[model samples]
Target: MVFEKIVEILRNYKEEPELEVTMTSSFEELELDSLDTVELVMEIEEAFDTSIEMDGTLLTIGDVVGLIEKAIA
Candidate 1:
């Protein structure tokens, strides 16, 4: 369920017409900068009804999914 929501959020932000995303994809691979990460974190917080501390760590889609799973659980 969290994976699906993350995918939906990411899909909405695709700048190109044919960008493909996957679980192992990194934020750098997705072209997400600091500002984009800020926004994505906010959306994730709202979706999970929990808080996330950046600590300058999150790198991959899998990382975010893991955090979300922890928060939701």
Candidate 2:
């Protein structure tokens, strides 16, 4: 459920509608810059209703999913 929501948020930033996304996909690979990352994080926080400490360590979709899982646990 979390992954699906994350993907939906990400799809807004993607140019290609058919682009493939997976847990291992990096923000860089997704063409999301630092600003985009910040925005994405904000959107995720709003959608999930939880705070996420923005950091340089988060690199992949799976990383974010894990954080959300932990945050709502």
Highest TM-score: give the candidate number. 2
Model 2 lDDT per residue over 1-73, tens place: 9998889888865656667889999999998998989999899989999988789999998999999999999
Q: Give me candidate 2's TM-score against the actual structure.
A: 0.90
Runs with alpha carbons beyond 4 Å of true place in candidate 2: none
Question: Could you give me the TM-score of model 1 versus the true structure?
Answer: 0.83
Instruction: Tell how far residue 30 is off in model 1, in angstroms.
Output: 0.6
**What clash pairs does model 2 have?**
none
Residues 8-36, model 1: lDDT tens digits: 77777664545676779888888898889
Q: What's the TM-score of every candidate structure?
A: 0.83, 0.90
Estimate the overall C-alpha local distance difference test score of candidate 2.
Answer: 0.89
